[model samples]
Target: MLIVGLTGNIGSGKSSVARLLKEMGARVIDTDQVAREVVAPGTPGLQQIIDHFGTGVLNADGALDRPKMAQIVFNDTNALKRLNSIVHPAIRAQLLKAIADYRDNPDAPLMVIEAPLLIETQLFKLVDQVWMVTVDAKTQIQRVIKRDAVTAEQVSSRLAAQMPQEDKLPYAQRVIDNSGTPEATLQQVRQIWSDAIDRSQAQAE
Candidate 1:
């Protein structure tokens, strides 16, 4: 299978692009969703996190107090790393299983690993091609503010934690300009995926 790594800044429309790709027959794996799943109430991931972060970060019913954890990580760099250390590996394992299961089927032609931290976390190595979705910094800030319902300062701080758009360009084999309308983005991605899948098929043979 052609494993395409899809990534973008906080609100650059990676999920929307992934949704469009899924509609076009690509199997899409979302790491953020998988991370949440592994840590849901009755899981080992949840237990481990609780063990580390303590009950202060858990609800009365035992689900994670995401806001508490988010508040902790945003201001404390080490706390963010600790959280990632606890969650990223499990998510990676799950994502690998998903990729393997999909590839085992002869019919599986292409698949996508939709992850925000693909480049930052060095996940681009696993995929056949790395695609970065980009928008102007102003657009990114606007979208993220609306999406996260946070202040401009909050958005800027979060965006600053990762590598910039220009830095990602060197690593991205394909770039999707999501600065345009959703329809235009979808059109571009479909064309790119078609060409990318064709190349991957040729290489595998």
Candidate 2:
């Protein structure tokens, strides 16, 4: 399989691109969903988090309270680093297992690992290519504000906590500009999907 790491800043429409790839018959392992699974109730991951951040980060059902944890970490660099230290390894392990499961599946010629922190977490190293989705800062901010229902300041702070788009661009094998209309973005995704399919077939030969 051709493993592609799909990443971008928050509100850059990485999910949209992932959806397009899925619609194109690519197997997409969303690291965000994997992140949640690793930390679900009764898991060692959640226990470790509780041991570090205390039980306050958990909901009444013993689930990780993501919003509360985000509020705590996004504002504090050390807290965010600490959270990543605990979560990244677990996420990586799950990703590797998923990749291994699909590696020999003939039906899955392309596998896209979609993650917001692909570069930051160094997960891009596992993929054959990195496809970055990008949009203007203004559009990014607006999209995030509207989607997340948070103030501009909140969105900006979260964005600030992440690696800058410019810094990540150098690592990308392909960049998808999502600043335009949905149709335009879809066209870019289609081209990338076609290229990925060609590359995968060549590799198999």
| Per-model root-mean-square deviation over C-alphas | 1.7, 1.5
Give the poorly placed runs of model 2, Cα more than 4 Å off: none
lDDT of 1: 0.86
In model 2, where is the ten-residue run with the lowest total lDDT?
A: 100-109
Find the number of clashing residue pairs for candidate 2.
Answer: 0
* Candidate topping lDDT: 2
TM-score for each model: 0.92, 0.93
> Which residue pairs in candidate 1 collide?
none
For each candidate, the alpha-carbon lDDT, in order, equals 0.86, 0.91
Writing each residue's lDDT as its tens digit, candidate 2 over 1-205 gives: 7889999999999999999898888899999899999999999899999999999999998899999999899679899888888889999999988888887564666889999989988899999899999999999999999998999998988887789999999999999999999999999998888888887778769
Task: Tell how far residue 57 is off in model 1, in angstroms.
Answer: 1.2
lDDT of 1 by residue, 179-200 (tens): 8888889889889978977887
